[model samples]
Target: MPAMDTVVPPEGTILTERRGTLLLIGINRPAKRNGFTPRMYKELAEAYTLLDDDPDLRAGVLHAHGPHFTAGLDLPAMAPLMQRGEKAIPPGSVEPTDLGTPGYRRRGKPLVCAVQGITFTLGIELMLAADCVVAADDCRFSQLEVKRGIMATGGATLRMAERAGLGSALLYLLTGDEFGSAEALRLNFVQKVVPAGEQLAEAIRIAERIAAQAPLAVVATRLNALKAVEEGPLRAMGEFLAVQQRLSSSEDAAEGVRSFVEKRAARFTGR
Candidate 1:
């Protein structure tokens, strides 16, 4: 991480900003196509930890500061960190990929991603781990790790089959063939596609819509959905009734009912 006291953009690092209820995380190595150096990866995990722990933050947006979302890992500097594997993360840091590596926990909030240009390898995996994505029409994607003689250790191998189906994911993962934004949408890898330069705006718009809802309800919905996806539907179903009962007894639930009766928007305080 760069000196927290310094304002200049470092050679490679992540940038974070609090945008109302949304925490915006930007990949800031534009000079290197926003690739992740070891420090950047660590910083990103810390940023995710901030989003997870901060009560005032309702959601997060991950995007790059340049034309490309990311060119994957910065091989030269990243090689050393890759050797350390999960040990690369410091204690108390959130694993940005949400792989549930023992010490880290997934943020109990929604994350929306925006991408354009060279969205390859780790970039695609990052999106696969996120809730939804907005892609610029010019975006290109691929799981290029195989071409480099390595395979994706990121969540791609884990979540791709779940998100895009086994065959579709295998075709690209095995061959490392690049696909465009349209193909990404067809594979259900991206939720929305817009003209170049509109990705961030659309992503933030969606995140703001999420933030506008009842905070408690929003977190509950995300938690239940992730539980269903990560832990299997049976386990999620087993807890569904209890979860709903808890939410139904909250002050926000009463506000939801009163707002419905009065035909006004509900005011949620996350209580």
Candidate 2:
């Protein structure tokens, strides 16, 4: 494992580190159940931007340090912003880019998230941005913005339909209802549900497994999958191999061959 770099944010809200090839981002406001202040969002955005440029990072896992994964947005802090008429991005103001991070392009790397306890509104939105999600067995999920007389402004409004299908997404969004982990899993909103305390560890394990794979091939696979939806299935096959061919010369690819011939587990350097 490489030496991991730690990043600590003010207000003790964000904890970041590179664990092997897995970039772990922890929302650390346990007192308020990991609720987001505007500052937290800004910090998270900055972290994502930094991760986008890191060549050493092969995969990422979003996590929280607390009993509850998140209680969603801090209404007390955010009420004033809403009152001031500040809002999420205006419709069609710009094309959807990089999971709707204001002006940034998409980071092609795969992201996984571990969720537990009170997931609501923005908490659910966070999952929409992740490529895969794992929830604690007792976790709760909801999109309660409708109860507050507002609509989801995050990617959930768009991604949810594709992620969970129109019926399931609409039921939760329109009624502002909450569901438990079993329901979430059955509905395809979460990939796996582990015991309550094991979410982060399981997520990290998955990320590390992904990190051990061919980095370029992983990105290419994700791209082709997404492209098959937005572009076309016919184009995806060709695009997939074209990318895999380019990755054949990468250092990690060479290490994979050497390790196989040496009859030992491959120690990927993530080159």
Please, what are the lDDT tens digits per residue for candidate 1 over residues 1-271? 1122244355587889888899999888877888877788888888988998898998899998878999998787778666766445686677778787776776678899999999998899888888889999999898989888887988898787887899998999899999999999998999999999999989999999998888888888888788898888998899888888989999989999999999998888778
Who wins the TM-score comparison?
A: 1
In candidate 2, the residue pairs with backbone N, CA or C atoms under 3 Å apart (3 or more residues apart, or in different chains) clash, namely none
True-structure RMSD, every candidate: 2.9, 4.6
In order of appearance, the predictions have TM-scores of 0.94, 0.84
Which sections of candidate 1 miss by over 4 Å?
A: 1-10
What total of clashing residue pairs does each candidate reach? 0, 0
TM-score of 2: 0.84
Structure candidate 1, residue pairs in collision: none
